[model samples]
Target: MNLRRLKYFVKVVDIGSMTQAADVLHIAQPALSQQLATLEGEVRQQLLVRTKRGVTPTEAGKVLYGHAQLILRQCDQARVDMDAAGRGLSGAVAVGLAPGTAAAGLALPLLRTVRARHPGVLLYLNETYGSTLSELVMNGRMDLAVLYGGRVAVHGLQFLPLLKEQLFVVGPASLPAPPEHVPLRLLGEMDLYLARPYNVVRKMVDEAFAGIGLAPRVVAEIESASTLTAVIADGLGATILPESMARTVVGACKAWQCRIIEPVIEAPLALCQSDHLPLTEPAQAIKEILLELVAALPGSLIAGDDTRLSVS
Candidate 1:
């Protein structure tokens, strides 16, 4: 089957109309329709059903759509890789990172190293949640990603454990000190600013609370770690975040970092990529730089086999 024809079919299904798909593809409507028909014949099934509103995918079309998306993404990656090979030290590397993971001081150093080592390479960063990042990597939208937790069991992906991060309870300096180590119960009573449910931090927090048989009362939800810290600084509410995130901007906040001891919360930091995906020169270079950055982080900040660091 022609890859171009499959692309046309996918585009038509996406737009729900051959006319619109043709316009987007800059081809005549008849040509686009003929291509779709030819693709349907090749598949030996009715891929789309025409309706008064627009075209809707048949059951077989839905399955083909999924495969088509993957094929097209791989094709795009191949083109990018070839183009990069043609230009010395030049290519594109797309990286997706969880919100606080970037703030934890990995993103900048990695980008800088890539720039210095491969001046022609284009670095693209996407700040996203763990699940979203995982999906992007699996689908070839991103060459690599830094995820907050341990190896997520996504098919065709390989995860390298980088570090284990501890969670900390942060509050305005004005808030009274609870103790050397704060109890989980204390956090339940305080107004809290939390990440949305999709975030790895939120999952960790929920698990911690579950261990203690309590649910936290969240006063606000913010997506960005920087914004969460800024809000905490303004005395909006206290929050539980990775120590890596707290330390990253500790100088700017009027916040006190305290240990949450009742149920210790820790999650692994990992570098992930599709196992079957071949890295371009630029991607490989960036990966090496990322490993270097991970190595440079303070050992005290990372989880050790024998010792678990407390948030305080």
Candidate 2:
């Protein structure tokens, strides 16, 4: 079928509602429905199962969805290949890093590596929350994302487990030096400022607290790294972070970091990209360099308990 119709179908499935997809596509709902009917006539099979909540792919739709994703990705790649015919590997590759995570440290190194390897290529680096980066990658706006939460099962995206980062509790410099290893309950007893629940580290912290049948005394849900750093500097509260990010935060705010002990928690770091989208030659080169840099991260920050991390 035509690429336009396939795109419409994919958008509808991604959004899970005909009306919503039509709005997003800037088309009338009747026109979108007719397109779907035409697609069904061509395939001779009903593709979607509609319900009050939304629409889900039927068994036949499931099979087509997989193939459609591949086909769409292949077409996109073909365009890139044509554009780069005389240019040698060159194009824009957007990469997203989760702010306040160890991935933030990767920005400079990634920039340097890509520049040295492919001077002709353009690299766009963005730092934001992990969930937002993942969304951009799924929508094909970003080529790659280095983010926490590899252990999450996100639709339309693939995660390549890179490494695990040890969790640490950080506080202002004026506070007393904590025990060599701090207990989770000790932090629970104090006021804390932390990332929003969508953050993988936040999710881990919440789950750890839940294991003890209690919740953390989070006074604020701070999403921006600058905001978190400013609050920590003022001694508003202490929060948990991965080893590298914790060190980065503490360095900025004159704070101290100590590993948590009661139940050691680690967040999985991963290279995220669209499952069906093949990387361009330039992007592939950059991705390889990124992996090399990640593999060279300091041993102290890497989690010792696991050989690899995965969603349970």
Candidate 3:
């Protein structure tokens, strides 16, 4: 298949409108449609369907879209690698750090370390949910990520266990303070604001609460950092978070934090990357520095024994 047609198809799928995609691709709409049609013919599948809402991919198109992204990414990386073959390591390395996880702490240091070591290399720091990071890494859009969970191995990716982060109960200063190390059962009585059940830390919090046969009285579910900070600053409710994130949250919102005792809840932190897509020189250097920083993290909670897992 032609790389140009695959690029056109991806652009169309991304924008979901033939006209909009044409505009973004800086081509005529009819010409863009023809290219897409040629791509569909080459693949022998109805890749897209016109919808009242715009263009939607067919089942086949969805599968193609995934592979198309990976292919385009690899092609771009190859060009970059070849161009810089003898010019010293230089290329963009996208590193995703799931916000509110232990890895969020690495952003500034990673940038600083990379800047000091490989001035030619560029770093892209993305702070988002782990699921989004995992999807990006799997699709080859991201070079690497630092996130929690992934105890079971995921195909095409690798998880290098870095640390076991403990959980904390954090709240604004206006609210009555809890003990230095509060029991897990006490959380059942507290008004809480937490992420949805899908979050890795949320799953750990849920399991811990379930073990005590009580549900937390969550006043609201907050996923955004800005919104969560506002809610806590207003003393709307307390929240349960991993130790690293709890410190960040408390520091930002002038909140108080305490460890969760009785049954100490902990989440695994891991360095994730594509097992098959070997990193470039610069990316490998960044990975090594990242591991060193995580190792020297204050109050180190290095993960036990389990060194490998899949993204799932």
Candidate 1 per-residue lDDT, tens place, 1-312, comes to: 899998998898889987788899999988888988888888899999998899989999999987898788768767877776657766678987777763337677777787777888889988878888888887767898887755346567887777777778878887876776788878888888888876777888987898888888888888776687678778777888787776654567887887778777777787888787678767887877776677667542333332211211
> Please, what are the lDDT tens digits per residue for candidate 3 over residues 10-114?
988898998999999999999988998988898899999998889999999999999998888778878988998888778889999998887877888888888
Off by over 4 Å in 1: 80-89, 102-104, 248-250, 300-312
lDDT of 3: 0.85
By TM-score rank, best first, the candidates go 3, 1, 2
Error of 3 at 194 (Å): 1.1
TM-score of each: 0.84, 0.73, 0.87
Question: What is model 1's C-alpha RMSD?
Answer: 4.9
List the candidates ranked by lDDT, beginning with the highest. 3, 2, 1
RMSD of each: 4.9, 6.1, 3.0
Off by over 4 Å in 3: 19-34, 50-55, 299-312
- Candidate with top TM-score is 3
lDDT of 2 at 258: 91
Clash-forming residue pairs, model 1: none
